[model samples]
Target: MAQHPTDANVYFVPARSKAPIFASVSMFVMMMGVASWLNDVSWGKVAFFTGMAMMIATLFYWFGEVIRESQGGHYNRQVDVSFRMGMVWFIFSEVMFFGAFFGALFYTRQYALPWLGGEGDGVMTNALLWDGYSAAWPSAGPGQVGGHFQTIPAWGLPLVNTLILLTSGVTLTIAHHALKAGQRRALLFWLGLTVVLGITFLFLQAEEYIHAYSELNLTLGSGIYGSTFFMLTGFHGAHVALGTIMLLVMWFRALKGHFTKDHHFGFEAAAWYWHFVDVVWLGLFLFVYVL
Candidate 1:
């Protein structure tokens, strides 16, 4: 079923239809909905809901085309390699994106927070808050805006979640090898287990967030402390959700017998995303939670 690239009518899946338009229009609707929700506008909510609906429809049709092509065998070895490379680079960009947030966390705590404490120029406010605030990082003083929030200890649940993610990465690697070795049953078992682990990590994360908000009183409005904390951890959690969905799709594809020893770019793509999310969590634990 694979056609030569040079074939003008190449069964190479020029089966193009409404996917592009659908994806674009669907995204537009989502944006409108988001804008409305933010601004508290009536049409904004309407637009936002409409947009979400459109986007869901669009993704369904768009991915259907990809599935169709995959099922029809337009993707061969070369195509699979390209898909792998593309996913690697995509995850790399995402790493850099999270790194920016981490960088901001470092800068705010080390530089901006001190200056604001008036060690040099921020002397007035520092004197006001600490009566002689020394302008150091981890400003766990009365001057600290979230002065009341008890910082979550890193040795407990955060560390446990870290181990879970690291273990998931290993399980995923085993599953990938199983697939390549043509052990379908082992592959299915390991992959399904990996997805369950991912969901468990997310559930633990939700519990952590709840603890922070209700008992610790660490809120988003808690000032700079609240802001940076949420910005770093929230985005990482979002990536985890996305990575889980990618794995779930691959799981379903495996159920349908969609891949082979040499042609499973789709499965590999999901694995790549999962690993990327795993690595980001390590960074989050070390920098955001622990340090």
Candidate 2:
């Protein structure tokens, strides 16, 4: 039996479960499989897919259990607080993760390029290494590592995607407010719009990548610029995909009448993640594309 939401004194301590151990096993297998694949092992691809399937299955079961517990009223205010704190830390870790990549970009552009191009203390280095090599924003190094390449135009697909993401953020916020106000119809409509915008953004990004690779000669191998551009935008796309999935799930739950005006942390968590993704895209737009 589960307690009501008001019973905050009794913290629900779930029984010891095998989910954690299984999750660990899945991750270990997946990592090992990827490592092997990178090393060109014969069975690596099959092993990697197998491990991925196992991990996906494990997550599905684990999340289902948690959803059941939540809907059963096993979660009190304390549990809700714990969940909130957990989400906060998770987002914080993501911020750090992206920060490291951005830091690398900054270091390459500001320090490494200037130093290698004979600026200040690098005069001797430049004279000895490449003689007349000049520091530039999108250089492929003095050696021309990947030959000639062009950069994607910031005013084109990138701008469109930015607008789409910003609009999605607005729609998601509207959906959140609708959920909080007990307006199920508006909640579903706006959330569905957000999901559509997310998918559209992903489609445009794929088109951009295709254009970069086929026509523009911009690829991961192009130069430092290409690498950083792909890394930042690619990872952000993955996050957008994940956020879209979360929003879709929340939309389904909303259809099932699973949330209330006062008790809708699940919806709120998804909204938080979506907003974080939107903010990250804004940073990417300014730093990677426009600048």
Candidate 1 lDDT, 187-259, residue by residue in tens = 8899998899989989998999899999988877666667778888888888888888888888888888878
Clashes of 2: 0
* Model 2 quality (TM-score): 0.94
Q: What is the C-alpha lDDT of each candidate?
A: 0.80, 0.89
lDDT of 1 at 12: 54
In terms of lDDT, model 2 sits at 0.89
Candidate 2 stretches with Cα past 4 Å from truth are: 1-6
lDDT of 2 by residue, 55-97 (tens): 8889888888888888888898899999999999999999998
Best by lDDT: 2
Instruction: Pick out the ten consecutive residues of candidate 1 with the lowest summed lDDT.
Output: 2-11
Best by TM-score: 2
